[model samples]
Target: MKTLRLGPWPAIATLVLSAVTLAGCDDDDDDDTPSDSELATEALLRISRDAPTELPDNVPEDLRRVTFGGTQYDLLELLGRPSGSRPSARIVAAYQTVDTPADPPPLGTPSNAVLPDYTRSAPAAQVYECRQTGGVFAWAFLQPEAGLEPMTTTPVPGLETLGFDHFRYPGGIDYGPPTGTPPVGPAWRVSALALNGGEPTFGQTLFVGAADVTVPNGAGNVPLLRLSNAARIDQGLPSDVFSRTTSDGTQVGYVLRLDTVGGVAPTAGCAGAGDVGKRERVPYSAGYYFVEVLTPP
Candidate 1:
């Protein structure tokens, strides 16, 4: 089984952005500190921030065998025959379950934050891709629960949660989900560390896309490997995107280029002026797209 590592929580920004100051609300009330509403919002935001990005570490023993490097036989053995699969690409499998459990797990106590009910069954699909070295597993893309609006209520300490309700934040004051459709849904999402050899290298919200990472043929180009540049831009990292097919031609994904960043070397086998690195295939779907970060030399 592949081990996942949870990164330490970086400092979080306050979630309360309302300009309404408690200036004259009650001069008699001298506790100038933030109100319960503000506290509650900040606490919830913190809880969301601290939540895990990959599947729970304690996934039931029955479901634990299904991982990125596991095979199709292993997946079928655990998940049973999938609800649907692609004929062209038998490597892809889709499972429909009414019992999809809450993700990110409920933040039990102290923080006092709770996810809205209804999330237990909010996830409708679980898709997995079978690749050579990576085996059969879903690419860590996050999808929000469709049509489920964020509800406001008194936050509770422990309530079940799902990835959809969890935001894909990219650091800074705006600690929330991306504005447009995210690359992967809640059921299929994975963490940045999960992709980086289980080591925490990027921010909590960074979506790591690999070059030549392919998806099983689905309804459309389901980009199993992808990333978002918003956070990189925010951090002053090189924002130019590029792509290249894996040597075997079995996968296609994106990679970031730091052409302007000094000390970067040219890619082997790839020779083109300013092409720095070959570009990889992108999903047809419209949304924020990015590539994996290249280690600086």
Candidate 2:
């Protein structure tokens, strides 16, 4: 199981940036504090400094399996994609050659399900409350508390975090059922962590509907879920904004909760009316795939 300690981290990020920039400078008396980009890079390096480089034989080369800082992300479900899965975004498919048509269909799994925009590792809790539903007492799912860490790829093995920075978010997974409730509708209060020049940056808040597709993972773990995006929360930002902003990633599509570990509500916890207000926080960790569209824009 993966573990993460959640708390306020601005001070920590600032300290990291200070220490790194100070150590690198000798007497260059221009700028002491690092840029937002530099600070972001340092934070990303610190978090993923301990991931194992080697992957199991079962994992595909197209994907990554990271075990960093005791949080192992074996995205087992994404390993060997189906034959229907393709690399083309729906936009490209929509513009199929009426004038200059390809002799063959574009390469890869042909399904509308293209690869993810990027993946993240979230060690979260599936909060549940014993509420009366259908006149019976049961454990109803509440919101999820998690911190998202962007997964990055390195051209060289040992130099993974050197050039890449995966920003960390002290955030939560806000959920509401697909019927579209008013109060708790947004799916993720968590900042969208998107990559900028190999550095992960925080973007806007993501809105999504709950569980459009649900697949049972196991007896002891939470079910895999697909939460479709509700809006284009982060869109039309300037490319030049990447350097100035802490994050500039557009996130308005789908969120897949694949490769789950735990967080099952107790089957026997709520027995009667007496247990109506009981609460439980089942611990879980999942590999989250964030997709912009059926294909990238």
Candidate 3:
């Protein structure tokens, strides 16, 4: 079968604009009515933007093949054609590990999840703090820490390469964690090298709060999360931490942590007084998709 490329995104946008114009020309008697062209264009736009770049003919084993419907996706593998572009299904299923409970919370997608603007993979550590939970002891989540590199997107030479002193309390206003509270939350940053022979700087910083929704990943693996961020997560906002951001996630509305592997905390160690304050970072990996934006030309 012959493929249709539809030129570039710019051309697609032009088509969508034309469709909107057509919608505006609907009969005045029914101003709310949408023209057929407008409806068709909207559907086409979604299809063209979201269709998988490649089908999931052979799912990699170590990618922690746990998805949110949520189960083994042999059917996806069976239906997928390896050599063709499938502008229909979002072939990359969902993420949440094996350890998720049998009667788990309903699975959900990230807010405003249409099609991602960029997807990056990260091999990371889910940092945990061993502490007393009421009377019993357990491993509590401290943060999901990772040094992000290119996963699904091509590496840009100067995209962001900088030193972010997560420990540095801005302007010497120390809250006194020794490292000064580490900016108040789990953070994701993109750093870029300087072009004009200056020091490298952070391009974007995402400080995310607790998950708005979650899905079980699998046995002995951490759960996948759709963390919320209305551009920024915390209220009052960390002046010291986010002040340096250039984009402030203007292009990125929200992010998805999918296709996970590993990162589950050990249950054995956090069982007693001796384990108090002990920290561990279980190795894990996930694909992160940063989604949709209103970009100006």
Best by TM-score: 2
lDDT of 1 by residue, 1-297 (tens): 111122432222211113112211345455555543333333334334332222223222332222222332232232233322321111111111232344433211123323322335443222222222223222223322221121223343322221222222222233233323223212122121111222232212223232233333234334232222222111111111112122333332232111111111222323333332232221122112221111111
Higher-scoring candidate on lDDT, 1 or 2: 2
lDDT values, one for every candidate: 0.25, 0.38, 0.38
Error of model 2, residue 126, in angstroms: 0.9
Runs of candidate 1 exceeding 4 Å displacement: 1-36, 48-121, 124-226, 230-297
The ten-residue window of minimal lDDT in model 1 covers 232-241
Model 2 lDDT tens row, 119-191: 2243346667889978878898765655444433432122222221111121222222321222233233222
Q: lDDT ranking from best to worst?
A: 3, 2, 1
Question: lDDT of model 1 at residue 165?
Answer: 26
Per-prediction RMSD in angstroms?
A: 20.1, 17.6, 17.3
Question: How far is 231's C-alpha from truth in model 1 (Å)?
Answer: 8.3
Relative to the unseen true structure, what is the C-alpha lDDT of residue 21 in candidate 3, on a scale of 0 to 100?
46
Task: Give stretches of model 2 more than 4 Å off.
Answer: 1-29, 36-38, 41-123, 155-183, 189-204, 232-252, 294-297
